[model samples]
Target: MIQFMLVDDESIIVDSLHRLLEGQEDLPLKVWKAYSADEALDLINIIEKTEGQGIDILMSDVMMPGMNGLDLSALIKSRFPELKTLFLSGYSDYTYLQTALHQEAFDYLLKPVDDETVIEAVRKLCLIIEEERRLKEQEKQNGMRLKQAQRMLNDELLRELLEKPLTPQQLADKEESYVQASLSVDQCFILLNGKVDQWPLTYTEIEKMRQREMIMELMVSMLQPQCSIVPYNGSRHLVWLLQVKRMDHDSETCDLPQLHWYLSEELERVQFTIQERMGLSCSFVISGHEVDWLQIGDVNRKMGELLDRAIGLKSEIMQVEQAGEAMSRYQDIQLQPQEIKKQLLALTGLLEAGEFLAFMNELRSFFETIRKSVFLTYERQSEIFITLAGLYLSYMNSRQMTTEVGMKLDLTYLTNFNKHTDWQSFGDYCVRLAEILFLIVGDDAKEQKQEIAEKVDNYIIQNLSRNLTLQQLADHVHLSKFYLSRLYHSQRGYPIYQKIKEQKLNRAKELLLQDDIKIKDVAAELGFENVPYFTTFFRNSLGMSPKEYKQSYQS
Candidate 1:
């Protein structure tokens, strides 16, 4: 039975209400009676401490001696926030009290209340409490089921099955979760890996979350009824285990070569659709043969190896068989694919960080990536070496020194990836270029030029009253007048002299604004030859003399 409390200043009223409520077995309430608010509060403290619960309903008179119904209700609610309160007030008191209090509900019975009205109000509150209990129980059960579903449906389970040799029980778990029903029939799964070339740089975390879901939905639309699992573990990559929906499987099962082409073509549509709809340059590498459930780990590793090389590469699509040269070369030795991938991927970062020693150490494995690349054309390879040489030479001249790097080592490999015909000699020359980047300490010559241009503008502004010449500006940033002029023009797209003239003109007009300052004084303050020279300069810029411009402003 739910607990109830009744409070009134009169002893007879409290006693009558308590007996009246307790008699209704259907509404079943254990009623507590109190003649005053203080007595009601004292009884509540005992019930809370002893029964480990609070009163479910509290009904009290609005106007009493020490504490009225409104004040008592607020005090009890602070302890038990969900406690339901009903006020006992006359018609005049109820009208005024209703506006003063706004709790979860403003419910009450008027003074001289009938017995049926008291029973009905308490009955309604009990039903509401019971319904809330039912919903809370339902939500708890649903939450447990959702957690179990998330564990079963996540990509971790898919990865574990593909990457490790599972125990029989583990195998049974995978089967029960996704494969048990299909065990009676023949099935083919193609492993396809996709990498988003660049996530939208401008997207906020919330927008990117929505974009990922939309892209996955697009992929599922094309592959469903054929796809068993696609678990994207919130990486830059998406891995799908696509079960081929083949009708004529009897002959197609043996034709692994033809099957490879067919499966890859189907997966390519997913790539094309995402590229078109989402505007993300995604690269993919499909498994070249039908994947056996037991042999999944082997295929996954090979695909991962090829993907590692293709990841930083532009919109590249390939299969295992396409990289025949690298595969054949590796057969003669343990290729250490992971090491080669790290060496290749590290070049851009190593160069940026100016890590000369690290570059030299990894040069051997670095060359291995270029030599083993199936997609890099001879022209592209030549361009790669040329670009590296240019970066080093550019750094050398950034510090005003142009020195030839190689005498003994052949530099022709700097023209082409295979030109020197000797890896050690080529690497030796490249090491010298790496040395240039390390020693300079300043990366990106463009950024260095921008800094020089900014300093020129600041110097001209700060020393405007002095000799604000091009030579002085160049001297400020430690560059020659000729080179500084060229550098500033490259960054700002205007001549340095034009910039100085504009600054002097703007300053002349500003200084001329003061009523106490004369034209001659303004000219001297702006580093002009005389008032005549400053007047000529101002008239040429604004088609008005400085005196006339100041008068126009004053008007």
Candidate 2:
């Protein structure tokens, strides 16, 4: 609604202008009358505070007692530049006309104004006010869209930096464009790879995605105070660039051990929070040492390789070791590729049939057969490990599982062949892998239904204020709308829509008990657009309007 204020010392002139504006049915104007400029200013302030926007138009006599309309318009324009102004004067003085023009008044009317002239002036000014408001709103929306686009571009750049090789100058240019704005190249940075472990095996794909996002946010919140972090979410892993400056006076020396200790403490807190709040566990691997600005990509790859190897280890925080030790551990292994292929085919068949015990027994027998043979060299053993890893990866790929599952394997033993002290140790690793595979494919039809139902319930509780639809809820958990409706009905003994309404009403009842909240605001907060509809809904559900419910609670 547009607001208007008319100021004149003469009661007759103010009354006449107010009546004319108030009578216009075509103009949706809330008219305010002021006898003097001071009163007008007071009323305008009140309107601004209450409505959160100033009056749309000000129509006042140019020759007022204390402040003339021209001076008043100037003052108002300085504060509320959007407010339109029109001046009224009895004299046809050129000086008055010049002052009105200088003040940028919307229109100047000689006093004893006709009804048609007054209405026409207001009508034209109203159109201008609306146009300006529309343009401002458009500009604000465009700015928001631009920011979202920029964030998407930055995420893409981060991904490209990890996956593709770029020249040093190209990397520097990209960093200058995106990274330098928030972080400095002079500071040392560590790239960390993170994975959420034992996320509920029952969660749907969408639920898992949401949980990963939640964990990422939790980690950022925990680490933000110490350094600037840039996180990228991938199919199976989360990557972060933690940038920090050395506080030591010497530029050449940095207390990396102390920094790692501090980061470990922070990660422990993150682990606890994720477990306590979401019933999930996370594993993080940090790059062993700080790197120069241009070496982030290399550090990221190195950390990723370390994380992959550390998957089966009990430790949650794995750091890259010194380059010499890491290089010395690598041994050239040679094996008959055809023989390994034949064995992997048999292993795949066992895993496919969900024969967990038989899969372990067969793996032990194969390792025993290999150990007794003269061909079980270090290179041959590593080849066997790589082949087995590939077979498992292929199996998961066939079932549309992600590569992150590889993290559950004891790859650390693969890198350090000596750690596989005997055939039994390798057999133990195979047993663990079989167990995870069994869990992934073990659930029956009824169990799957129950899992979907629980996911739906969790989504509803998390978004009670959102006026959720069945299709929206189904899409969130990757279920068909029809199937989800039937499942939810069978599990809860009620329709899904009814459950949504019940939850909203129950939440509304709780909120209405608070004295400070307004009934309309509560309705809006609960996703109701019309206050009357909300009132009716409340009365129908609880036998009382929200206001009455609040009053009763107070009583």
Candidate 3:
């Protein structure tokens, strides 16, 4: 709603203008009367304070005993730049006109004003006000969207840092963008590698993210008092950089042992809180030594290797020092391909049957058997890796799927067998390759789903005119209604009912464009019992009636 105010030295003029404006019901106006410019300013202030609504238009006489309309307009222009002013004058002198023009009056009117002139001036001001409001609102929404995009970008950058090495200058440049405040590299920091344990494998992706966020928040709150923490994405783990500082000395010369002791105590508290409050256990590994700003990438790599060894040993908390000797104990053992072939065949059957738990169990058993019998020498590990790589390649070839270049290069690295820094690193590489294979091949269930989806699509196209239902489609496909619906949605990216409607509408459009088809016949052909219902559906979808659409096509 637009608010208006009228000011003049004569009380009669103010009352007459107020009455005229108040009678304008179509203008959506709130009118105020003031016998002088001082009174009008006071009224505007009161309205702004009480209702938080300012006047959009002001109509006042040009000549007055005190605070003439020209002076008043200048004050209003300075204070409320958005408020429009229209001046009324009894004199047609050039001086008064010049003053009005100088003050940037919206419009100037002679005495004895007509209702048409008053209403037209106010209406023009209202349009300007509305357009301004719309632009302001649009600007606000765009700002919010930009902020959300920047936040996502920040998270992506943090995740990339964990996976790749960045030089000190490169890291400094990224900090200059949007990550400076969140991550600081001027001080020594320790990388904490954490992974959630005992989380149900059946949880959806969204549920897992929520659980990870909860754990991350809890860990930050518990540890923030001791040091600064920055969380990064770890795919299947929670990674953080704990900035170490000392009150007595600068960050570069802080007491490293004391900082480590403080972190150890805080981590214990954090772990206990997570277990007691959230019913989940977490494993953490701290970097062995304090790292300078640029050495974070190297430290994180070391911590990752230690974390993998800890997982293999089934230990919750492990220090890098504990794995030093085990990492150096690589031995030379002979490869037995025939013996490994039997195990691989059994594992392949489990994978092809979509038995994920059984497959993982069998894979773990094979690894354990090899580890116990031999020392997992570099040569023996390479042979095992080669066998696994060949199996994966064969599987992909049978499915007619192309492997990524990075995966091919990684497999070639395994073939060279020189990149294994230790047995643990080689073992980690092997397990990662197995995961990639599982993801690439997918489960046998999805294969069956794709086949069923293809059949359903053919049926939908052929039976578009039928009154199709989920139960009817399921019967035709010879599957339960619930299972068919779920499988179809998973494979097709939408519900079965929506797909049916979409297909029906598409066919209806085709039939409507034909000159031989009647409107009522088109509706009936698509299983619509009533023509009006079909018309409404078409109008909602395309913003026009079926008849109108056909007419447009002809035109």
Best by lDDT: 2
Candidate 2 overall lDDT versus native: 0.67
Write out the backbone clash pairs for model 3.
Answer: none
How do the residues 1-555 of candidate 2 rate in per-residue lDDT, one tens digit apiece?
A: 898989988776687678879999898788999998899899989998998988778888888899888888888788887678888765544467667766767666654345676887788677656655664686596684574466576777777776566577876677676553355555666777887644442343444665776677678778877666777875446887776643453552235455566776788788888888667767787775476666777777766655444323222665666533543333233235577668777887877765554665677667655544422334455667777767666777888764545544445554454454234455555655655564446452446557767888888778876767665786786544444565567667776767777878988998888778888888988877568768877887898888888888688
Task: Supply the global lDDT for candidate 1.
Answer: 0.62
lDDT of each residue in 1-555, candidate 3, tens digit only: 777888888665576568777887777778888888888899989988987877778888988888988898888778888778889765444467667766767777655344566777787677666656764686596684574455476777776676678786777777665235455555566778886644542233444565676687677767776676777656546787777544444443335566677776677778888787656667787775577766667777777655543322322555555555544443234225576778878877876665544665677677655654422333455566677666556655666654552433356645554444333344545555444443445454566568778888889899876767665777676554444665676677777777777888898889989999999999998876579768876886788999999999999
Instruction: lDDT for model 3, please.
Output: 0.67
TM-score of each predicted structure versus truth: 0.37, 0.36, 0.38
Which residue runs does candidate 2 get wrong by more than 4 Å?
1-150, 245-258, 322-555
Superpose all Cα atoms of candidate 2 onto the true structure and report the RMSD in Å to 1 decimal.
23.6
* lDDT of model 1 at position 116: 65
Model 3 deviation from the true structure expressed as Cα RMSD, one decimal place: 23.5
- Candidate 3, number of clashes: 0
Worst 10 residues of 2 by lDDT: 326-335
Sort every candidate by lDDT, greatest first.
2, 3, 1
Model 3 residue 82 CA deviation (Å) reads 42
Cα-based lDDT at residue 371, candidate 2:
42
User: Which candidate's TM-score is highest?
Assistant: 3
